[model samples]
Target: MASKPMNVVVIGGSLGGLMHGIVLKRLGHTVRILERNPSPLLHNQGAGVVAGNDTQDFFQHHDLTHRSLAVTSHLRHYLDVKGNEIHREEYAQQMTSWDLLYYVLRANFDRVESGYCTLPPVQDGEGKATYQYGHTVTALRDLGPDAGVELSFRDRDGESGKRTADLVIAADGGSSTVRKLLQPDVERKYVGYVAWRGTVPERSLSAAATAALAEKFTFFHASGVQVLAYLIPVPDGALEPGKRLMNWVWYVNYAPGSAAYRELMTDVDGKAHAVTLPAGKMAPRVWHKQKAVAAAALPPQFADIVAKTEQPFIQAITDVLSPCNTYLDGRVLLVGDALAGFRPHTAASTSQAAYDALMLDAMLRGEMSRQEWAARTMEYARRVQRRGVEMGERSQFGRHPYAGTYPG
Candidate 1:
């Protein structure tokens, strides 16, 4: 136990929020997480994720199982305009689903087997952390370093209340309400493109399709369009071959103010969505149009995956980087996508969250001063954010440096 256990409130109870809660609680802080959704907030049905070093290190440090949590691919193949593989390289990527990693972090924090991870929580959380679903954090403010911070929240039924915490961690996501409150002028810049993502069960595709796509991070790029696909565990984290899902992401450039952009964002309810069209929400005509476009642009291998998928979704690629992450004399800190939203090309957002948690823990443990903590974390965010943008531009423009290289 610490000399003083600060009351910590984490906004947005997805990956980032849960990660911060686990790390803070591990250091003897009393934690309360506020999530807006009544049910589990599935950001997407599932996202194909690449677990980099920061992620694996976090799991190891926390005693969580990381190996069996993901589907792995030993090689990557690049396809030509036709479906023939023109480039083959050894590319080992441990690809996990968003749900799997989220639940693993949850299980570790609660010290229970959440059915997502075989490893039970190694740390004790008798009364240290509490997760409150259906609670919306409407407002919060720093009352000075001495007075800590005050937060106002509203539940699903319209009841609203206030509470005080010695520290506040806004791990809210890219479209973060807390972040807007702090820096309203920092808008999310639309990158004039969209990604259509979907997953097909291994059993649904033909044997030829399986052989072409199975066990590899396959990619196709041509004329400013890119498609990447790989296998991922089933919804329940089942890694059996037939039980896994083949996840695909097709990136297409779309002008922000074009008529096509407006039509693509119209949901089934006839409402225009700004960012993401979730699974089962896109209008029938819109999705049909997307599939037709995929057929015309992508190679037949990827076109087949799109045609077979039951629920394909689209997200307008956007960028947001805050000038500063720390505020109110360090009583309030922004973490994860809330602090800086990155392009998904590098799949570095979750890794950044994991790094933030570890670094914040170190700071709380008195390893660095306030200024040093802020400078280092902000620097990391800037560097990774820049790298992600570079990769995104390259992939979006069909100009990858590794276009013809086969490392193996």
Candidate 2:
């Protein structure tokens, strides 16, 4: 399909990297995915994701199994303090869980055995894809002229090696090592809030809670807080009733550097993390205090969902927008959150990754120039990043600066 098959190296084996790898490999390019994690990434720290158009389209085109991936909600409802619905709208959205998507993608890309997908990897005689875990990229070098880029890496066993490819893709996420190496001045800007997130088994919830949240996108907003709940597939992608999970996120403001923020951000081992405190690692005392707050502040239905959660986690909201995603004369590129990290209000992170992968596919197919692709991708990133910030400001700070100017 292409003028010539190019060797490709993808850093990070998460959604963004896997999407790019799958697309390029299908186009007859040799691809190698180096993941820092030492094992199969079957677990995700966060929960449900709204399956936007880009995500749906990517699966339709690339995923071979063509399995059902989401649970649909046909109604949207807003709740008051008493848990009574004050506003109702007919809205339909497909909700997907993080683990389901990850394993499905992995099954499609490399056919790693998992409960999500049991099919073997497809052998289409296009190109070969190799996956390596426990490889941490240590440095990057761009050879001059037609030569490609070289990357040095050390594995978990402290063994170091190097590889070169005609192109390099950095999908390492918000705290990307590749991004930091290229743009040392860029950093993650913390917003004045954090999200408390957890999931409860549908059967574990009370009848009242199930009646309120089942098959409905539910939300509640207070002066400085916003909470939402929706149903997603279980860990193995089961969507049947009573086998699903009710995922909820409550956004609460805590000023940076305050004692409250410090106490909440510190994990059970007394270590501080800049972004997420993963499930099952949160300190008991911190979780209890937040549960007490939920009892006092949240509506009864929402409060019950929180109480039933056994391992709630916290994600500190942060934003990062790089000036550009192209680097090293276009030999290296940054996509997804590495290019522009959005606030969670937009719920467009996975969609952004899908969009980036689609655009990269177009570029590799000679459908667009590298310059054009870069401009289009950066425009999309900035627009989504701005919209996420505006939405967060409106919901968390009661500001309507972008009321009539929201991006489509």
Candidate 3:
């Protein structure tokens, strides 16, 4: 176990990457985060996060300001196929949007200027952590058994550079470049379905709809499909009623490698995408067709929510199972989506990244060996991946009145 500090470069700048950078810096390492984005992140515009325990721990441990970034609901409402509320149970959970958490993490990371609407960081430290935006990581290779790791990078100015770090942490997300380099044979398998997601501000809804959804976690299940709706802070991470928004996702199945799948990935410009079509980039015809389906199949409440949304997006759900996470004589490591992409059903990806960071920090501080860290992380990834699959499959559950809607 080595307690001495090391230079670390983290690829990818999303939640996973940022978390790793923060955790590593706290453990006394010099850390730099490479974000492929050309500029600072645009806050308050990302999808919602369920905020599992591990996710919460990262914020709590870092002492970041999070209380104002999330919204809480104490009731769970289950609706019928027609969108009629059939049963209600007391539930308690706190959720935040990805934009909010990202900005919060970014603020604590370095002296970079977070955008206009970001909440101030709860704890600002020595500023040992820095982020390099517009820098894309090209490749990483070890010089020799003990000669350190070399990193190749390309900046937005069309200039290229190289650097060496004692450790390389690849948290570049599910479509990770480092993961592709290390495990060339692995692929993100499309899980035969897609999710249609959107958000409508609370003020945009009717009084009845507002009353039904405000401060509530809600859902509706259909044959091979599931619809979930919840409230989240609005564009500025504000919790004021009118300023909040109702976000929803409808998961519907489609065959992988099918024409429908390819068509769904098509953008407004007619360019076919390999994965998601960003908000407002979905061809109008596709959203129009989905509106028609919502009108006929979804509960009236949800149908209204979908109809009023101004900027909806589509994401193709995919997962990967990577059996190994450490390489280069344990000098290089993979974390978060790079190690293994899991079905979102577990809501574990963010939390898992935190756990990975925490565990890695501990091991580097002499709590465990690199070999043990690799084995434990690999086992944990497989377990979490399998659990997500099981949870994704058992889609229909809860109060019995809606059993008929289950996709048998």
Index of the highest-TM-score prediction: 2
Highest lDDT model number: 2
Cα lDDT, model 1, residue 183: 88
**With candidate 1 superimposed using the best TM-score fit, by how many Å does residue 61's alpha carbon deviate from the native?**
1.5
Candidate 2 lDDT by residue in tens digits, 175-259? 9999999999999888999999999999999888999999899988877788899999998889999999999999988998999
The runs of at least 3 residues in candidate 2 whose Cα sits more than 4 Å from the true structure, single-residue gaps closed, are 120-123, 399-408
What's the candidate order when arranged by decreasing lDDT?
2, 1, 3
The candidate with the higher TM-score, 1 or 2, is 2
lDDT of 1: 0.81
Candidate 3 C-alpha lDDT tens digits along 1-408: 444677888998888888888777777778988888888664333477777777777788863444566788778888886557888898787877887677777776663445524444434333268788898888887887656799999998989999888888898878888988889899988777887888998888877677777788888877677888888877556877788889888887878889888888888898887657788788888889888888888777888899998888887888787769988888788998899888877768888898898788678778888888888888889999998877666662233344335422
Q: Pairing residues by index, what is the TM-score of model 3?
A: 0.91
Full candidate order by TM-score, most accurate first: 2, 1, 3
lDDT of each: 0.81, 0.88, 0.78
Candidate 1, residues 1-408: lDDT per residue as tens digits? 124888989998988888889888788788999888886544556677888888877777864565477778889898865677888999798888898887777776655456666766455543387888888888887787677899998987889989898888898889988888888999988897888899999888877668889889998876567788999988778998889999999888888889889888888998888888888988999888777876766667777898999988888898999999987777789999999999888788989888998888778788877788788889989998898888788877657643432211
Error of 3 at 397 (Å): 14
